[model samples]
Target: MKFFTAVAFLTASVSAFTTMTPNKVASSNAMAFSQFSQQSALMAAKQVPHGGVLVNQMTDDKDAAIAKATVEIQASERQLCDVELIMNGGFSPLTGFMDEAAYNSVVENMALEDGTIFGLPVVYDTDDESLQPGTTILLKQGDLPIATVELTDKYVPNKVLECKQCYGTSELEHPGTLMVATERGKYYMGGKVTGLNTPVRDFPCKTPAEVREELPDDKDVVAFQCRNPVHRAHYELFTRALDDPLIGEGGIVLVHPTCGPTQADDIPGTTRYKTYEVLKEETANPRVVWEYLPYSMHMAGPREAIQHMIIRKNFGCTHFIIGRDMAGSKSSITGEDYYGAYDAQDIAKANAEKLGVTPVPSLNLVFTEEEGYTTADEAKEKGLSIQKLSGTKFRKMLRGGEDIPEWFAFKSVVKVLRENI
Candidate 1:
């Protein structure tokens, strides 16, 4: 019998896998997919991880053995995020949680053993020190059995090193740093996972395989990553990205939002999902696609930007939008930004060649009094009148029942925010 991994199905058109040699890392010039009008393109169509999409299917014979497992461990919310992405092929080429070696490699360098540019380390960390190496742990979320893992390696990690490498600082105020510094479990477990079923969620969560089917294979797809509600400027930025001359005609946008736990102050995932749903119906644009990811926001700035690119590649996106301070988070105590405004753009641009997904710098669109919406540069050059409303001001309007200008946001989106208030 022949076994086929999920990546095999995703990259069916290509027979040979392309590895990224150090020399392949070229200048960060992301071309619009349409510009590659040739008999063959440089990058492969589908981007899979180092080993391929790691899928662990349950064997018929092993079901009985799993049922008889002695130890049952409840999975934390973070671990469930890993389980959903791993099982759904979103985290392609990762079979399960990272082993100690893999974790250490990712911490020291953002690459796996074979030099795969993986951004973050995904591990099953728990404070349960008693879960021995030989134990068969049944991981469950809210009383629902999701996966079974045989603990092969259980060890403590250097938390300081992990945070410093991934987040660039170990400050307690920074959310990403805080997570690694304080929230994660002490002991990390590493092993293969036998997925039984995906945990149920209230919001719409689709796997990469499902999204690929919805996207047209021959057309250009640009992915927009967002955690906040889509304001008019944001909508303009991504939609206009497709209109760039370099981008061939008939390009569509994927409005992929991270509907998972983020900063403590950001809008709730459930609330954000409603806004996207309303906006999708209100705008009624066939060019824009909607999907939600269960990825927990690490706010690792540049590194996280690369992580988004890799995941979107597996989702069948040819291009990804890298905006100012993408995936940026702040320090709660000091109220300071963790990364520079353009750091993510620079990093993603540098790795665009190796990542396969072209990086489209997000347009800085602003509303003009006389000319609808235009890029900031265009507005300045043409001396057009521009209007602005800070997020704090918008929230005040929403709360005070003030009129939100049609130029700033969709009425439908406003309705969702107003209802929440």
Candidate 2:
């Protein structure tokens, strides 16, 4: 049978096999239908959001929400990112900023009040202690109103406790801990949000529903989360993830990069987005789908992996690729890594089954003179000559106008970075 015809046959036979008794259906056809049914059920399970419901807080009447606002507050870049995700169902199971109960629960147990796993608390922070509950506030980007919140509760957050619990450390050296301690406001506000407009951004972030619509219903969708420009190794890693046994055949990888506020020193979102656009045009891979996510990075390592998985699950991804030291950061003073290399992979793997999303550990790939982009084990066994380039060296090369090896980075991506940086 032709490939398309075989698919049609399996789909058509599934229903018939379900209704037929034992020995009534042909054994070979029955086996094919059984496999097809399992795949269908798996895909169906992935479609369900983390909390079994996808939350949509976007308001149809923007004028009404604007008029109801008694106070206006300019949102920070991070807050804007959070608002976009919350409004678009990227932060499903979350209708708005977390209340005190929810915040405390997530900080203490990494879960919501209802025992639903939530990696971190999403709360609105402000220094204005005079703001009271039952008041309406409009959150804006500059003069443009983006979302409105009906304040239900306001409380001082335990910054140290939150940093320790969510990020595994309360040290000022840790970026996430530092952010919570110095950057966040004194008061944490909670309310249901009504989105008025999405912030103006260089890259348009698609809603979870929109992304889900583009994904294949019968094939597994593997999510690759990144905050930087895609390099050649990064390309090989995600593309190879499609061939993983967990993904099986006909699976596709979603190159979903966060085009929102990341580390202060990282590439600008606009520049990074441009690099992706150029690389996508250059490669034109059919098995890959590129999309942008408006999420602010926390550098919380293991905990952040859970957060990414939940968000991708809402976007209809069945699996997530967990790389070494995923979302990890370093100490500004000692320059020591905050989390272990395998910490994220371990935590993500531990929670994968419960989240309904499988965690695919990224291969430790290395570049060799004899064979390009082979697993570290294979290179070591063959005693191949390995090529290595550090990030510090790469940046220097970009500054010096040195030609970068195509094995280390893509030519198109290098061109964009060189021009932008």
Q: For this target, which candidate reaches the highest TM-score against the unseen true structure?
A: 2
lDDT of 2 by residue, 1-421 (tens): 1343223322221111021111111012222122112233334534567766665677788998899999999999999999888887788777678777778788898887667788988888887867887789999999899999887777766776787789998787887877776677766777777888989998988888777777878788899999999999999999999889999689999999998877778999999999999999999999999999999999999999999999999899989999999999999899999999999999988887778889999999999999999999999999999999999999999999999999999999999998999
Q: Cα-based RMSD of the predictions, in order?
A: 10.8, 15.3
**What are the lDDT figures for the candidates, one per model?**
0.73, 0.81
lDDT per residue, candidate 1, 1-421, as tens digits?
Answer: 1123222222222111122121111111121111222112113333333223323333344577477567988886778888777655566556557777777777787876657677898888776757766567888887788888766677667766677788887666778866755567666777556677777776978767667767776678889999999988889898899987646679888889998778778898888999999999888899999999898899999989988988888777888999999999878878788899999999888888777778998888888988889888999999999898998998988899999998888898899988875
The lowest-lDDT stretch of 10 consecutive residues in candidate 1 is 23-32
For each candidate, what TM-score against the reference? Answer: 0.86, 0.89
lDDT of 2: 0.81
